[model samples]
Target: MPRRNEDALNFLLERRSVSHKTLTAPVPSRAEIEVILTAGARVPDHKMLEPFRFLVLEDAALNRLGDAVADRARALGLDEDKVAKARFSFDNAPLSIAVVASLKQTDMIPEVEQTLAVGACCTSVLNAALASGWGANWITGWAAFDEPFLQDHLGLAAGEYVAGFMHIGTVRSEPSERKRPDLNAITTWVSS
Candidate 1:
């Protein structure tokens, strides 16, 4: 008889992301963020090569990043609307965790596996924040994929890339439940 944590399972089944626009001030404290980060780092890592790291962005840092995003958008000849959209998350966010995929060079663990582990880390962070009664949303935009922005502003190394930018804050409104995929439509049965 395996022990079943029903509450944890229930939370997983009903987990939903709050919009960054709706995430308000009174973000988690440093101590709370530390706990969230601890949960984020507890994902599976093959060969024990923890190939991920986090950057906590708050207050002035968020504003600075937003400004950088706007600049990058303009430099790339993006329209004003595009520029605003690009910087919206940063401008509105109370706090954000940049989940960076810092790959380690090792033949033992494939690059793909390392990348997947980083994704898991991002999900863990999002779930942990949500479970802690805060509004949380995982996001990535053009800035996340732009090499120059990543290297220049975020200081990502050669093999490092953004897995996600997890925004955490107070929930302004309860998000309506969106449509969910039908399990039967997506799942495949396997039997031996």
Candidate 2:
């Protein structure tokens, strides 16, 4: 008989991302983060091409990125409130892991698969952090897609971009469960 871990199943079934703005202090330590990252790397990769990487942001870097986001927003003619909103995620993040989707040029594996692998990596990271007892959320605003911001702030290369920012911190308040999709409405079962 195959052993099933109920706790793991329960964790997955009830997983919910904590909002970055509501996240506070008491984040995972350096050692703990290393463990989380290690766990995050375990994902499906076609052709053994590791198509993802991580960039850890803390303290000053978070603030700097926040400032850059605000600047970018302003330069784009966004109003004050909109600019502030754009930067809010970074400004409030205690610790964030930027999941960089660095794809390789290969005819064997499609670029879309590489991108999907990166997205999986992001989910793995968020799950790892949440399992480690820290509040976590995966976020990416306009700053993630801005070429100038990616190059200047994150130092991403020509083929790389941010998949998500996995923000980790302590929970100030428990988030109430939001309405979930109805299974019957969204699912189709086929049996031959």
Candidate 3:
């Protein structure tokens, strides 16, 4: 039998994403971030088809990304609030990572499964950041889904799209816990 790690289980039980707005400076160093990204990469890849990649956003890159989002929103004639909100995610974070779901055609793997792998990558990245004593938030806004925004800003390929942006940095305050799902209400069991 494998050994059970109670400490790991406890950490998972208490993990809560910090609010992006409240996440401040002194983000993870490049060396530290490399460690985190490496952890994210160690996930199940169906048929050994690696369907995801990560883009680190820090310092000047954050400004470039935020400005592009802001510009796109303005060009679309979005209202001030919408425009501001669109750029805020990228602008506020001291560091972030774009988890790109870049799927390639493969006969052995279904498209849905590829997407699931990317989604798993997103969670893994977020968890890695949180476990490393950093505040993190998983975010995807209008900019993430907008074709023009993704193309011009993120440079996503024809079939690629963002799984999520993990906003990671120092925390200003401990986040208030939100309501959680009732596991029993959402779960179903069958035995024969």
Candidate 4:
């Protein structure tokens, strides 16, 4: 018989994301961060493509990225408030892992499946951080979809794009449980 991990299941059921603004420094050390990434990289991959990679943003990198965001904001004619808001995301997080999806053209697996694998990597990173006793949240804003921002700031290559940013840090406070999807309503059973 397969043994069940009740605690792991419980943690998933009760998981809550710590807000980006609430996360503080003294984030996961390099050693621990490596472990988190290791866990995250173990997600499913069709044809074992490994079509994803990570870019860690911390300290000076955060400042650089924030400046880039501010520049993009100004170029886009966004008001000061909007620019600040955009920069805040990068400046505030103690550390963030950029899960980048780089899809490859292949006959074996569909490009969409490769992209979905990248999405799974993002979730995997989020879960890994949470499981390792760190506050974590997966986020992506206008900056994520902006090509110039990604290329110039994050140094993403031609096919590379941000799947999600997994913010990791010390948990400031516990968050109240929000509503969950009605599984029964969403789930449909079909039998032949």
Candidate 5:
């Protein structure tokens, strides 16, 4: 007989991501973050290729990121409100973890696999934060897809891209349950 971890399963079933704007201060400490990162690293990797890395943005770094986004938005002739909202994610959140997808040069493991690994890493980080009782959300807006912004600010390589920007902090409000896709409508099972 095998024992099942019901608590972990229950947590997964009921997990909800809190908004970055609704998060307050009292962010996780270095050691606490390390634990979260450790959990984040446990994502599914098809070819054992560690194709992702984390950039921990804290304190003044967040402000710098916000300013960079604003600058990029202005340069691109984007709406001020949109730019401000994008930047606000960093300004308000206590901590932001940038999950970068660094694609490896390999013919055996396709680029898609590496990209999927990066996506998995992002989810892992978000789940880890939520499970740890910290308010967390995975976010990536126009700024994340802006190549010039990424190159100028985060120094992202040509082959690399932003998987997601996960914000973590203490919760300020209780998040309401959102609608989820129906399993029967989305799932298909085949047995031959």
Candidate 6:
């Protein structure tokens, strides 16, 4: 019989991302952040491509990124409010770990699979932070999608993309429970 880890299952079922804006000071130390990164790197990698990397943004870096986003928005002639909102995640969060998807030129593993691996890495980082008693949220806003902003601020390569910006810090308030999708409606059993 397989051993049942009810506690781990419950944690997974109950885990919900905290808002970046609601996160405050007391960011994780270098060692603690390393732990989170290690956990994140544990994600499954088909063909062992490991086509992803992380950029740890703290203190002045966040503000610099915010400025870069705003500048990109202005250069693109986007609405000021939208531009401000695009940078809201960086402006409010004490620390953010940017999950960068570095697409590898591998015939064995498709580019789509590599992209999915990066997304999994981002989720792993979020879960690691939450399990370690910190407030964490995975975000990807307009700034993340803006190629010019990413190239100017993050120095992303042509084949790379931002999978997520995981904000981590102390929780300011208890987040209210949000509605979840009905599993019955989404699940399908295939017996062939």
Local lDDT at 24 for model 5: 84
* Top candidate (lDDT): 1
Alpha-carbon RMSD to native, per candidate: 0.9, 1.1, 1.2, 1.2, 1.2, 1.1
Candidate closest to the true structure, highest TM-score: 1
User: What is the per-residue lDDT of model 5 for residues 1-192, given as tens digits with 9 covering 90 to 100?
Assistant: 989899999998999999888988899999989989988889888778899988999989899998988888888898879888988977887999999888799888998888888888899999999999999999988888788888889998886678899999999999999999899999999997
Instruction: Name the lDDT value of residue 67 in candidate 3.
Output: 90
Alpha carbon deviation, residue 63, candidate 6 (Å): 0.8
Across residues 1-192, which tens digit of lDDT does each residue of candidate 2 receive? 999999999999999999888899988999999999988899999998999999999999999998999998999898998898878888899999999988999999999999989988999999999999999999987778778879988899976789999999999988889999999999999997
Cα distance off (Å), candidate 4, residue 16: 1.3
TM-scores, one per candidate: 0.97, 0.96, 0.95, 0.95, 0.95, 0.96
What is the lDDT of every predicted structure here?
A: 0.93, 0.91, 0.89, 0.89, 0.89, 0.89
Evaluate model 6: give its TM-score: 0.96
Ten-residue segment with the worst summed lDDT in candidate 5?
A: 154-163
Candidate 4: regions farther than 4 A off: none
lDDT string for model 3 (10-118, tens) is 8899999999999999989999899899989888888878899888888798889889988889999999999899788888988989999888897899999988989
Residues 1-192, candidate 6, lDDT per residue (tens digit)? 999999889889999899888999999999999999999999889988889899999989999888878878888898988888877878898999999988789789888888888888999999999999999999997777777778878999886778899999999997899999999999999999
Model 2, runs deviating above 4 Å: none
Residue 92's lDDT in candidate 6: 91
Name the better of 1 and 5 by TM-score.
Answer: 1
Q: After superposition, how far is residue 122 of candidate 6 from its true place, in Å?
A: 0.8
> Which of 2 and 4 is the better model by TM-score?
2
Model 3 gets an lDDT of 0.89
Deviation in Å, model 1, residue 111 alpha carbon:
0.6
